[model samples]
Target: MPPAKLKVGLVQQAVSDNDKATNWNKSAEQVAKLAAEGCECILLQELHSTLYFCQQEDTDAFDLAEPIPGPATEFFGELAEKHNIVLVTSLFEKRGSGLYHNTAVVFDRSREIAGKYRKMHIPDDPGFYEKFYFTPGDTGFTPIQTSIGKLGVLVCWDQWYPEAARLMAMAGADLLFYPTAIGWDVNDTDEERARQHGAWETIQRAHAVANSLPVIVANRTGFEPSPNPADPGIQFWGQSFITGAQGEILAKADADGETTLSVELDMSRTENVKRIWPYFRDRRIDAYDDLTKRWRD
Candidate 1:
């Protein structure tokens, strides 16, 4: 059984353009600090090693991809062992010369890889051209087992899907972690920006309520200019947060700065919440065959 009470930390930091070495060093320092603060598990934002290169598809960006047990994993593994904290991190995975994936790696305090999850959803929006870089994950919706418990690890785009959360919950995940990179276009109006941020927060909280599990999101913050001067850059709204089983906000960070958020999760609350709101027991699985169909034509 997993521990009843667990303290988790999130590193919501800004990224620098084309500076992977500096980013790794800074993140390691943050991890060390969180470990000192008694955080049992630490989560870093998606693509934390460098800028969000998916803003525009460039052929050279493929150079950023590295093997699973490559340098990046080794660096984080040493940190986990040194601090004796479970660490969750996201990376651009290089499967081979022509294949790649958006993957999350979980490390136990023993300095060994616990498990990994390949992001299932791939978004291809204007400033988030991910489909061009990542191949859709074939790893399915399996949760990663760690010392903390089963972790439903998903990427930015996967957080928006209810099916993903439900599958992870059914598979016995104690908490869901989204290592995300999302933001607004500089051209968007102030009102539109607020609406976007509100919607983002609401959707993830709803996932927590539906799954009867805590939801933790770690997102990058600050402004990253577009490579092409003609296009508006992205202002990554930080607001990293942790929510309870009932969708109550446990802790939230600011919108524009780098910070580490630590929160305690009561693992036993899921049972109490689910007993009163038993959505899982009444699921109409037999009547949802059309969910798998492309269209009902």
Candidate 2:
């Protein structure tokens, strides 16, 4: 059985250019601190080892991809064992010679590899050309079982889709964790930027209420200039946060700074919330076949 309460930690940090060692060391220190603070599970932001290389479609960026159990896994695995805490991290996965994926790996406290979730949704917007790098995940909406509980791990793009969260909830996920890398275009108006950020957070919070599961999001911070001089680069708006099953904000980080957020999640709250607002019980599964279609037409 899962514990009644789980203390989770989020590492919201900035990334510099090509400084993998520094990034890893800094995040490791943060993880150690969170562990000392009694965090049972620690989640790092997306692509924590390096900068968000997907800002442009440069073919050379493929060099950033590495194997799943490669250097990163070994590094974080040792930390998990040393700190005795479940660790969640996102990685640029090199599946094979010409295949890659945006992947999330979960490590049990014993330092063993528990499971992984390849990011299902791959966004290809301007200043965010992920489809050029990652192949859509073959791994379905299966929650990873851990000592703390079953974790519904998703990537940045997947967080926007209600279907992803619903599938995980139906599969018995105890909580939803999104290791994310999203931000502003640097050229957008202040009002547009606020709207984008608000939508990003509001949608995730709605997922928590809809699934009756606590939601945890860890996002990168700071400005990473574009490799191409003509481009305006991305200004990553941090604001990493944790929300309760009732869609209430539990903890939140600053928008432009690096910080660690730790919050105690009451696992039993899911049961109580579901009982009062039983959306699952009222789901019209039989009448939802049209959902699979591209459009009503």
Candidate 3:
């Protein structure tokens, strides 16, 4: 059985430059600090190695993609083994010529890859023009087995989908994690920003409530200017957080600060909550075939 109690850590930071070495070295310092504090598992923000470049699609941006087990995995893998902790990291993957993906790689106390998940939901909005870059994940919603527990790791856009979370939970994921890089459009009204932030936080909390599992979220902070001179760049809202099985906020970082947050989770609580909720037991699986359709109409 996985441990009844586990300690987890999240690293939330801002990216000012396109230097992978500088960004990763900063993240490494936090990982080392958290491991010394006795955290068993640590998650870094999505694409922590570079600035969010999807603000505008440029074919030249493809230069940023690298193969799996390349530099990122090798660097983070050493960190995980040195700290003897389960480390979760997100990267831009170059699968082959003209093939790329938003990928999350995992290392479990070793300088080797444990597992990886590609982002399934590709958002193609004004600022988040992801569909132009990532191919929808071929890796299904399978939880990666780690020493701490079964980690259902998903990228930023994937956090908004209930179907993704439910499938991971159904497949026996003990905890859900979102390595996120989302923020407000700087030109939006105050109210609009509030709504966007609220919706983002609420939906993930709902996933925890429905699935009876904890959720860990790490979002980047600071403003990354857009390549388009006329565009107001993304202000990556840092508020990285964790929630309990009952959807209670455990720990949360400030919205615009670089932070390393840690929290201890009780696995037994999820077991107890599921017993009373019993949502899965009563699910109408046989009658939900229509969910596969894009739209009921």
Candidate 4:
């Protein structure tokens, strides 16, 4: 028999500068709300402890990075156990002095550290200076195994990479989750802002259709100032959502609101879709060596 359906929860919230306590409390409240609504799994936005602080290369931001099993994990572990739900969290991981990574840590239903995936792609765009703070991830493409099924998780920038999604599907992931932090530069016109957000959501939906796995993305919302005086600040667009195996939007939150959304995910649909589409059966792996290179040369 196939695994039973699981109700997934996503939290979309705003953040303030360097306020871990506030963020934790807010997140805890959302967790409880979602659990009350029957969410079996919960996901939060990227670097959720602080406002998307990477907008500048401030030395002070390093203080936000913590060890994997450190304070936040311990707290979240307890919450997971209390709710009896799987928890997916994004954090700033302090690997060593001057070394850190953007990571996703999963707490299983039993409230144990089930698995983790370090973000492989670090974007260095304007108003988003992530490369300045995060050391590129060493963890390769892999999924976190839970009582429900394997979870294919990647960070914000990693969401744009189809190869990453494919590897997770090839590795037998039952679902895909992208804990994200992305938004519009306040300087952009309204039209540009709309287009950017649309593109971001559209691409992830494509991944769901191609890989035949449910996709969950939780994003932070609200305006965070640029740590650098020279750069314009960013308005983090929320719109956190969950998509089914067919890439259909299951639930989507407001672009600027604090919301807890839960959607029922049919675990069996993965195999059902794959059998009908057969994308995996026709492997072009033998002819895909160019994908490994920096570029076609």
Report lDDT (CA) for all predictions: 0.91, 0.93, 0.94, 0.88
Rank list by TM-score = 3, 2, 1, 4
Which model, 1 or 4, shows the larger TM-score? 1
Show model 4 residue runs off by greater than 4 Å.
Answer: none
TM-scores, in order shown?
A: 0.98, 0.99, 0.99, 0.97
- Superposed model 2: Cα runs more than 4 Å off: none
Q: Please, what are the lDDT tens digits per residue for candidate 4 over residues 1-297? A: 226788899899888757788889899999999999998889988888887878877898888899978988888888899999889998899988889999889998665899999999999988788999998888888878888788898999999999999999898888899998888888899999888999999999999999998999998888888877887788888999999988999999998878888988788887889899888888788999998899996
Q: Give the TM-score of candidate 3.
A: 0.99
Once superposed on the true structure, which residue ranges of model 3 sit more than 4 Å away at CA? none
Worst 10 residues of 1 by lDDT: 16-25
After superposing candidate 1 on the true structure, give the runs of residues whose Cα lies further than 4 Å from its correct spot. Answer: none
Question: Candidate 3 on 164-274: residue-level lDDT in tens?
Answer: 999999999999999999998899899998899999999999999999999999999999999999899998878899999988999999998798999989989999999
Candidate of highest lDDT: 3
Poorest lDDT segment (10 consecutive residues) of candidate 2 = 14-23
